[model samples]
Target: MKIIVTYDVKQILTEESRASYLDEWQKEHASLLRECDHLQFEMKRLQKKRPSDQKWIADQFDKEIRTRSERMSFLDFKMDQLDQLTLGAEIHDGEIQSIQEVQMGDEWHGREQKGKIVVKDGIVQSIVPDSKGKDIMI
Candidate 1:
């Protein structure tokens, strides 16, 4: 008797199983939120100082506050994107004739030979040349 088994790559890469990634990003987002709060508080305190002192320090505080505020907004946007993000996948048409025909530790080839897809944190980061060093167009 011959038996064939298939693995669903998509099912294996779903978001539920990848919650740790989101958790990590959330921690960074929280830190940014704290930094933003601190910057705002410092700006408010600077506003109540003597006019001469404020003149000397307000410009620096304003610049720092704006930079941190922008960074916080970007972090929030990134967290939102992560919440809606999905892993990419590609389905190739190929087949293994039989278990006996399959070689152990052999590279699997699709219809066309191409570069490898780099995946990091469930995201398609980049694609570089394969062993043959052939460029694969996206």
Candidate 2:
């Protein structure tokens, strides 16, 4: 059986791209968090003031608070996506290394008894024995 080796070059590149994305995300997240904290402090200070003195101010504060909340949520989602991409990249890199080692035609007889090779998500899944004399799987 002919084994199909799957490697997602796009995914690898996308994964590598996450470092920059993550850095930007982190900076934005920190800024948002700081803004939220400042907003909360201001809100508290406003709450202590005379309501009649700051008429209609609550609406503006509410809008700013909501906008900050939405920004935080979006940043959280972006961070999650970045984390997943980073993890996928690491897994794929490991798989690529494994495939390279296996394909190097090393002395498998003495080093490793027998193993089957399976590739998934741009990496090797497993290596099993071919008891029935079948073709090697990549």
Candidate 3:
């Protein structure tokens, strides 16, 4: 039988990758800001068009706008942390999923532990096991 597993991906910060990350983050931040502006404009227009339901409409728009605002703040925090990372430092990139085969009495964690995958310059570098001497069944 086979089972799907998820593993962590670690990225080694370099000048090239750092710049790329910054650019991507900045673009996302700008997009979210623009979305908020558009939503605010729509909220105003709706309120003016329907004064009787103005409060309800405004509340609905505020909820969505609040969600986006929170996300933007989180992005800013991430960008700041990225800026503070030293070159060559490993950072948690994301995760990857893989399928593995297993049999009866198989030690799942020992044999197929979801370890860390190291990357540099957008390329895979190495895979590290969580336990020493335990090989990852990649």
Best by lDDT: 3
- Tens-digit lDDT track for model 3 on 59-101? 9999999999998999899899998989999988899887777
Q: Model 2: residues >4 Å from true position, as ranges?
A: 1-16, 53-55, 86-138
Model 1 residue 101 lDDT score: 39
How close is every model to the real structure, measured as TM-score? 0.46, 0.45, 0.87
lDDT of candidate 2 over 1-138, digit per residue (tens): 223333322233244456656787789888988887888788768867856745466677778978988998998896786676534352222322123234454434523333234444445444444323343444
Per model, how many backbone clashes are there?
Answer: 0, 3, 0
- For 1-138, candidate 1 gives per-residue lDDT tens digits of 233333222212346534664676678777877876787788768777666687667777778767877876776775676566555423222232222234566545531333355443455444443344443333
Model 1 off-target regions past 4 Å? 1-18, 44-51, 89-117, 120-138
* Whole-model lDDT per candidate: 0.53, 0.56, 0.85
Model 1 scores a TM of 0.46
Which candidate has the highest TM-score of all? 3
Cα-lDDT of candidate 3: 0.85
